[model samples]
Target: MVATGKKLSLDLRVIELHTQTKLAGYIKLLQNNMRKLFFGSKINGVMALYC
Candidate 1:
């Protein structure tokens, strides 16, 4: 039972790590889209079609 408790703790740590990484990736993607919108594309296009 002690070993199983340890395993559960480790699993929770891994899940938290994955969630953080996923959030970071999402933020980076949003930044990229904002750059595209300001540089060459219009907000209309970016917001409507994601191009």
Candidate 2:
């Protein structure tokens, strides 16, 4: 049981890491789009909230 629990926790960690990386990539993409749309202006409140 302990081994299974450990394995499950490890799997969860891996999944969390994957999700974080995916989110980071999406944020970067959105930032790029915002920059293009705003002519390199800072990300505003609405865009920040979306990210």
Off by over 4 Å in 1: 41-51
Tell me the TM-score of each prediction against the true structure.
Answer: 0.73, 0.73
**Candidate 2 lDDT score relative to the true structure:** 0.89
Residue-level lDDT of model 2, residues 1-48, one tens digit each, is: 999999999999999999999999999999998778786454565677
For each candidate in the order shown, give its overall lDDT on alpha carbons: 0.89, 0.89
Worst 10 residues of 2 by lDDT: 39-48
RMSD (CA, Å), each prediction:
7.0, 10.0
Global lDDT for candidate 1?
0.89
Error of 2 at 50 (Å): 34
lDDT of 1 by residue, 1-51 (tens): 999999999999999999999999999999998898676656576667864
Model 2 spans > 4 angstroms off: 40-51
Assess the local accuracy of residue 23 in candidate 2 as a C-alpha lDDT between 0 and 100.
100
